[model samples]
Target: MKLTVCSSVLLLLLTFSFCHGGNIFVFPAEGSHWINMDILLQALHSRGHNITILRSTRSWYIKANASYYNALSMPVEKSIDETFITNLMKAGVQFVLGTTPWLSSINILTKMVDIITYLHSAVCELVSAVLDDAALMKTLEDTKFDLVLSDPCWGGGVILAKYMKLPLVYYVRWQIGEDAHFGIAPSPLSYIPVTGSGFTDRMTFLQRVKNMILYLVTYIQNDVISGRLYQPTCAKYLGPDCDFNQIKTDADIWLMRTDFVFDYPRPTMPNVVYIGGFQCKPAKPLPEHLEEFVQSSGEHGVVIMPMGTFVSELPDDMANGIAAALAKLPQKVIWRYKGKRPASVGNNTLVVDWMPQNDLLGHPKIKLFVAHGGTNGVHEAIYHGVPVAGLPMYFDQYDNLLRLQERGGAKIVSISTVDKDDSFLEAMQEVLTDPSYRENMQRLSRLHRDQPVEPMDKALFWIEFVMRHKGAAHLKAQSYNMSWFTYHSVDVVLFLTAAVLLVLLTSFMFIRCLFRALCKRKVKRE
Candidate 1:
């Protein structure tokens, strides 16, 4: 009887704890954002919080299991068609890396604007599709979730959170984007480089001016152009009273996928949390075949090349050139190639459809990582202390590579310039032979690993903290309410300029009157 009473007391305590934990609703967009969200969702689930995932499709990273409170897969057939996504990805590659031959003749800026228009339309359609789903919308409303987590990249998350009256949290993957302007973080136009500008924090006078112009252009594109596109859809779904401006500023917390160890030190708002390398996991033992290949390399070591999931297939000439370059190296190469096998691949090279990239990089035998400088790849390389030979493509890849190059751990080679066998080989040789590259990477790895809490834990803690505090409104920066002019003190500058002009004008008038009086007195004396 006494043992039964003790068990009842334990059960009561467990139930009380469960009740206190908040219910989190997660909405992950397609691609890498979905993959990143899987990690955070798993962490949150493990911490006893109930997690309900509302995804467009099944994620390869997220398994269907009992750990999650609920998993809802909504069809987005009318929203995201395959052809549109294909064209969008193609346009992106062409705009940034100049992949398509015919596209090379077209004006790059025009192509970029067209691509942005399509992407904006796609996002709007997605929002419409979600809001149109009566069952899904009703289900979401009935859940009465404590908080909503999503990547602001999609923009729909912000709308959903506001509509549901829940605290919104952003899972930002790229360091540079519209999130900076939304008051979630501070992205100074003077120093901090714009997303695709490819400039470093330390910029020359001319570069700083260029960066400032780029910032203005991006702001217009995102806020003015894209905002207009989003307004109608938001109004349609969220009612006419809904404002896009409110959605931009309503985020309660920003979980930025960056850290000072990899990115340059920049000012961030209190609500902004840095959880870089959150996706990086402990090294798992390589498969037998991979282990054998690594062992065969002996002292020369191995190089792992992956262009990420999106850019799986490379241009034939580029692939052949890269294969030929690696063939000459002493090190064995394991490349993730989705296209037809290259004829230039030597006995030392093994091209496969996929690779356990992070695990392979963690292996002690890994000497180099050749990639397109995606955030995940870059952070994984940093986590594993592997130097990079970066061939940056669209979006933040160029900026990521530039930062890695600045940090002395990477060699950036333009995709246009990489067709030459000698140049490609020379770039690879420099990274492999240079002692500074390895040393820098090793130092960064140490620093990245020396955090007070693991990145995943930090993310989980902050997410729950926000939920427990009921939106954590205290963390919002005062700057959130300020306009661009007020935030940067542009208004202050204008005010001071006006005051100075008024004083100067008054002085000029007083002197003119005095001179006129003196002339009148002189004429009377005459």
Candidate 2:
């Protein structure tokens, strides 16, 4: 009787533990990716999963539940200061914005290569710094994590997973790009735009050709240039046997920040899941001052201008021009500006360091959103049925805005147009006055919100599913094992061409012999 009771208790305990949770280690890349990771991590924590974040000292945001959701700050070099990050952002923004005429004239393929090369160098330094910390490495080694979740943008997360001998899951915060290629996802270059290609799904013949060329060039750059950069870093940390390509391809699951409602239809594998609006939540009541400010705008409504975290400030001329334009409008403007307050602030305009962006967008009286065309901003705008005036600056911003413009929910204002001031105001006015913009945005919002499962729930389910299935290896596409040539059927093409050539040669030889025999027979008869 005693033995049976003990066995029953042990079984009950095992069942309870299995039903509850497991250990999860999350390594998020720096910048806005961390914000997206926080949302998922918070959800995981709520589900009783023990979560630990391996983060840099300069992490942008830290969770309130520091004790519960543990963080190990990786020691960075003194040279890796805020100034360094700020300068990098500035240079990147300038390059993408086409502020430098020389850079603008450079071929897009060459520009992409340069961008990846810069990112590769930065990632190597970051990963090396973390690995060099002996104490942190020892602690991580001792911990028995069930799965490794990483934002694979920086190219270090996979290496960390390999070092720990753990299953890797990628929490991709942007549209599928090089990571998809590395994961062997079926991305047909003819349609699927390369990362930052700024092409919509419905492409012209020339656009398709451009897309294909971009993909081929990027593939070569990743393998030839970026691969070499990562090789030494992986060797130093994960040992000489580790291959970066293997580390990338071995990922168990990819939770992409994309939804069919927002993105154009493209082929995706079972392992690649779309969870675009996972960070969005129901709008909270605005703070008292903000509420009064929006209410004061009366029927004309308000416009919210937020350029995202990285672009805290704009150029002096641009800022002054925007301020001047806003002054002419009746609608109240709430501009999130971090630099010197524009001297031309009209009575209807408010300039602040930050505001509750989602809540403000959700407000019924919001006329339009003046955004820098960040994906998160676009998603929020679409979620709230708000039209946008997009001033696209860098990275996928142009692509995101282009799609919105195509869908009739937004208008794009080029930053370098001859009359940018007039163009900016015109776009803002157009989105505000155009009934089609609002109607289209409302339709899109319905589609986004009408998902069978909420994005957050979908993301959570897949995460736990991967944990339960121990990496969900069965979901990986067969192409994951295929070589580049074999996957594209280049080998088959070559073989078929060779066979055709051999047949042609054989036929010619036989015909020649027959002709020679006939000539000889004629001569003998003579």
- In candidate 1, residue 100 scores what lDDT? 48
Model 1, TM vs. native: 0.88
> Which residue segments of model 1 deviate by more than 4 Å?
1-19, 57-69, 81-85, 95-104, 107-115, 133-135, 174-183, 237-242, 308-312, 488-496, 503-526
**Could you give me the TM-score of model 2 versus the true structure?**
0.88
Taking the tens digit of each residue's C-alpha lDDT, what string does model 1 give over 1-526? 9999999999999888666667898766666666677777777777777898765452344344545658765555434444555566666665655554655637665766676566557666666766788887898788778999987776677777877888988888531244353345666767887777778888999999998888787767666653577778778767897767556666788888889898888877777788999999879999999999999999999998986454444567777788788899999999887777778888899888889998999999999999888888899999989999988767788788888889899998877666664877888999999989999999999999998899888888788887877788888877656666788899899999999999999999999999999999999999
How close is every model to the real structure, measured as TM-score?
A: 0.88, 0.88
* Clashing pairs in model 2, backbone N/Cα/C closer than 3 A: none
Q: Give the C-alpha lDDT of model 2.
A: 0.77
Give the alpha carbon lDDT tens digit for every residue of 196-245 in model 2: 67888778999898888887776776676445788888878777876676
Clashes of 2: 0
Which residue pairs show backbone clashes in model 1?
none
